[model samples]
Target: MTLSPDEIITVTLWGVPINATLLFTWIVMAVLTGASMLITRNLRPDVPPNRWRTALEVVVQGIQNQIAEIAQGPSRHLLSFVGTLFLFVAGSNLLLVIPGFRPPTSSLSTTTALALSVLVAVPLFGISRRGVGGYLQSYLRPSPVMLPFNIIAEASRGISLAIRLYGNIMSGAVIAAILLSVAPFFFPVVMDLLGLLTGMIQAYIFAILATVYISSATAPQTLSSPQKDAQ
Candidate 1:
């Protein structure tokens, strides 16, 4: 049985039920990363690339530009993570279009895991760039009194990010499934096109919001004013 994002498929191995969506997600991410690395390894800086290589390069460069423009300065170091995440999320979401293949991103478990990672990484990256003290100080924006609200808002964002993507994708898939089940022959094509578009936009949103969150968390609150400079 294939795992899809909306449903969690479990496999029994040695009487232990392992989550198939999680396993598939890990595999998809590993494959994407490995393929990118292999492409880099066999690259020739002076030679022309094939269409596949060119396309991959274009995607990578576009993601790099997004990261650079948002994060700015030395913060562009986050390009790799953003690029990898975008690829992983987009690739996983494509499983819906594949015949008999279920998307890993359709499941709440998978999306929530990814969202948690982004939330966790934000603080870690912030602390790494600005000392722990500076990172903490950034949250005390406007005034120290606002710190608790800021922290709560940050926590809610992670939940909202995960639930928003998961809900939309899952609901879309459900609608598509119902339509196909009722009219198997003529319905899926339109749904598939819509799914593709939605999938792409969702991936872009996830990555962009991630960049924005990272920028906000690591922003420096200067001594001159209450204005905090977000990444």
Candidate 2:
């Protein structure tokens, strides 16, 4: 009846009911926020982008450029937010891959919170773009029947994002633990190599998916374009 070490690694904070996964997530978020602020505070747009600032700037600009390309307009201000989100999620997901550390993203609750946050940001951004009234009205357009379906569809994306990440990371952790516990004699070279590759890839995927979500969320819904006919 004893809990496994893995199970014991509950996503809880202070035993106050905050899960370990969520605690780890918030830590990642804080790191990203603070680091970004530190890098940005002293930045001087007066001159060309410098190294300390350039590296961060490039990351931010790259995201903004990517988003603008998709959104068809300048997104300078939003670049930092989008870039920070990607980095934070990637970092959180990679934590478990580290020895003795469990990635917060490997748990459903952790990823769910992250996904829901992103989803919520979408409507907020939509409102900022089209105003509260306009944003809500977009749901009614193309047909009211589609409204319910659209809402459901939007909800499903967040659940899917959260579940997919948790499943993959947890599966990897289980397989690795099994190998260590049952077959310690083996070199485990191939497995270790694969683990390294998978770890980095998983982190990247988590970040990439996050960026996509933000791009979709913060992106303006244009009524002029053929898509959605949102007007």
Candidate 3:
């Protein structure tokens, strides 16, 4: 059985091979973009909201609320970034039910890319909220000696995020494949339903972890009890 989508070459453009990972990633993005455009094409306050619009709003609002709760602050600034991450991951996994479809998340390259995006976004959001100097200074909190450790921690976050997501999704795919081959036919169908649920859970987890990392960077640091007592 095929393990990673990277092994499957779907097309070649200008001598560069495009793997199933890129193919399905593009398909997911295109589908999301087209659906968004179609749903919002006639958006206007004067007109009554259609079912599609209502569903879209509910999803957006749900994400915003989750962000607000996690960050313990306003969520408007995070809606787009967090929402996109959740939707993309969730959408990719949910599509696994389709015959011959491979989830991009099952590939380490794709998960690494997503994790790296979160890595980059954390600092961008941090620097935007706190000046570059302030964000940099966060690494030296409590003592300058901790700077290297803090830097290491920051770097490790991306690696951990990538491995965690890739391992979970890839393992799921592998298990399902094994079960399909050896187990009863109906058993695989049950596993597919469970896989869908697992996919949604993983997407939620990835997004929440991203939000937590970003929120730690962007949220204002408060004075410690000792510092407060000194004042």
TM-score of each: 0.87, 0.70, 0.95
Residue 73, candidate 1: alpha-carbon lDDT: 60
Pick by lDDT: which candidate is best? Answer: 3
lDDT of 2 at 151: 87
**What range of 10 consecutive residues in model 3 has the weakest lDDT sum?**
183-192
Q: lDDT by residue for model 2 over 1-231, one digit each (tens)? A: 211232444554577565455556667778777877877786665856558787876766666666676555555545655565567656664554455555666666666776787678678777777688877776776788789987887788788877877777677667876786777768355455665567567655655665565455455655567665754
Error of 2 at 213 (Å): 4.8
Overlapping backbone residue pairs in candidate 3 total: 0
**lDDT for model 2:** 0.64
Candidate 2 Cα outliers beyond 4 Å, as residue runs: 1-19, 26-54, 96-98, 182-231
Of candidates 3 and 2, the better by TM-score = 3
Cα lDDT, model 3, residue 53? 96
Q: Which runs in model 1 stand beyond 4 Å of their true positions?
A: 1-10, 225-231
Spell out the clash pairs found in candidate 1: 5-106, 5-107, 6-106
> Which segments of model 3 are wrong by more than 4 Å?
224-227
For candidate 1, write residues 1-231 as lDDT tens digits: 322533454576798666767667777878787877777766887867877788888997899888878876665668877776787778876655677556677888878888998999899889988889989887787899999999999898889989988888888878887888899999888888888888888999999999988887777655754455442
